[model samples]
Target: MKMVFRWYGTGNDTVTLKQIKQIPGVEGIVWALHDMPAGEEWPMDKILTYKEQADAYGLHLEVVESVNVHEDIKLGLPSRDAYIDNYKKTIEKLATVGVKTICYNFMPVFDWVRTELFKELEDGSTALFYEKAKVDSMDPGELVNRIANELDFTMPGWEPERLKLLAPLFEQYKQVSAEDLWRNLQYFLEQIIPTAERHGIQMAIHPDDPPWPIFGLPRIINSRESIRRLLQLVDSPCNGVTLCSGSLGANPDNDIVAMVHEFKGRIPFAHIRNVRVYDNGDFIETSHRTSDGTVDIAGIVRAYHETGFTGYARPDHGRHIWDEPCRPGYGLYDRALGIMYLWGVWDSMRAGEVAKRA
Candidate 1:
């Protein structure tokens, strides 16, 4: 596996590329133009600026975490064609700069929802937490207010400009079922997959954050079966998955190892992280270590190794640790630690394989 780190960008993030390059096995940054709104063409100058910065530190900016899909596209609105055109242009621009994989999601509004940003663990480190009961019962406005109050960094899915119309957007999606979401996603894939293939960029769709619907919002890419269906939508190597462990792991039933074995070649990127699931149906993000959480991270790494995965993989959201105050989940300290943990596991697995062959 080719390990990469997710860096928001200079000024927008506290973690520098210098720091990221210091990580033993990290070779690149999984990045995007975070300040730009979805459906807008990313300025080539701005993309080159990031490229130059990363190159200065010997890091490749090849895997983009997200080129967020506009709600119009997800809703199948008439204006979606215009937005999709912008998306295609953005894809072309990314390809120009040597980006290999573009990670995007088709979730309606919120990218990922958490009732609490800093749910303190017993160990004193905090993590992004989702209280299922609270989320189920809390008023949507109250939840929004809570998220807005806690996070200083702009949360991925909760863009203020978009959330301002949350009520109406939710109303619009009321009639949109899971099947409708699947159809809309297929529509998006049909338009973009050919363009992506032409540009030599793989379109890697991230699974829904919790791998389940939230507040009645339809989430279709939540299971291995759904992923299989998604692959069938475009039926091209360019159409792929980001294969996020924490997201898919939230649903206990998802056989992530089976997914790795089944979709081995199609996954061009991966977000490997761990989460501790509670008996009450809630969960909080944790370190990448296998023992620290419910996810069998060690097994996951071995699976990747077994598949001979040479794709770009990054440590996903990590707990806030070591008094380092930054973006709640995107903090540098824990993520760097997470990287080393993953690398340790992968190296051991590789060594074991060599020994077995010998």
Candidate 2:
């Protein structure tokens, strides 16, 4: 596994590239042009600016966390063709800057959701939390307000521009079912995968945040079976998965390790993190340690090792520790710690391999 860190870019993030480089084994940053709206072509100058900054710190800015998909594309609207054209252009621009992977998601309305951003754990560290009962009963407006009020930075999925069109977007999806969503995703992959293959960039689709349908939204990338179906959609190496553990682990039924082993060649990126699930079907993000949460971090690492995975991997959501006051889940302290934890596992696995060779 090639370890990378998620750096939200200078000024936009509290963590600096200098700090990220200090983390042992982290060789790259998973980044994107966060300021650019979806369906717009990313400026080449801006892309080079980020590349220069990361290079200054001796880090690669190759894997972007997301290139946000416009709602038009997900809805399969007539205007989607125009937006998709913009997306293809952006892909070409990224390829020019040596980007190896672009992680995007097809979930409509929201990218990820949590009822509380800083739900305090018993240990005093806080994490992104989702209360199932509260979310189930939440008024959309109230939920939006709660999320908007808590975040200091503009949350990726809850952009104000997109929220303004929420009602209409929901209306657009009123007749759209799970099957329709799948068809729309397939349509999207068909248009973009060939371009991605030509550019030598893999389009890694991130799974739905909770790996389940939320608030009547039809989430397609939630399970291993769904992932298999997705691979069949484009049937190309360029069409791949990000293999996020925190997202898929929310659903207890997802066998993440097995999926890693099964989809080895097709997985070009991974977001490895842990979450503690409650009895009531709620969950909160936790440290990368196996004992700290439900997801088996060590087992997942071993599976990746077994598969000889040389793809880019990064630590996902982390607790807000040391009163650092960083992005809700993208804090530097815990994520840096998570990297060391992952590296320890990878190192041990490599040492074992060396010993066996001897």
Q: Backbone clashes in each candidate structure, one number apiece?
A: 0, 0
lDDT of each: 0.90, 0.91
Cα lDDT of model 1 by residue, 260-349, tens digit? 999999999989999988898999999899998899999999999999999999999999988998897999999989988888889999
Model 2 spans > 4 angstroms off? none
* Per-residue error (Å), model 2, residue 61: 1.1
TM-score of model 2 relative to the true fold? 0.99
lDDT per residue for candidate 2 within 86-190, as digits (tens), equals: 999999989988999999999989999899999899889999999999878887778888888877776789888898888888888887899999999999999
Q: What TM-score does structure 1 among the candidates reach?
A: 0.98
Task: Give candidate 1's error at residue 124 in angstroms.
Answer: 0.8
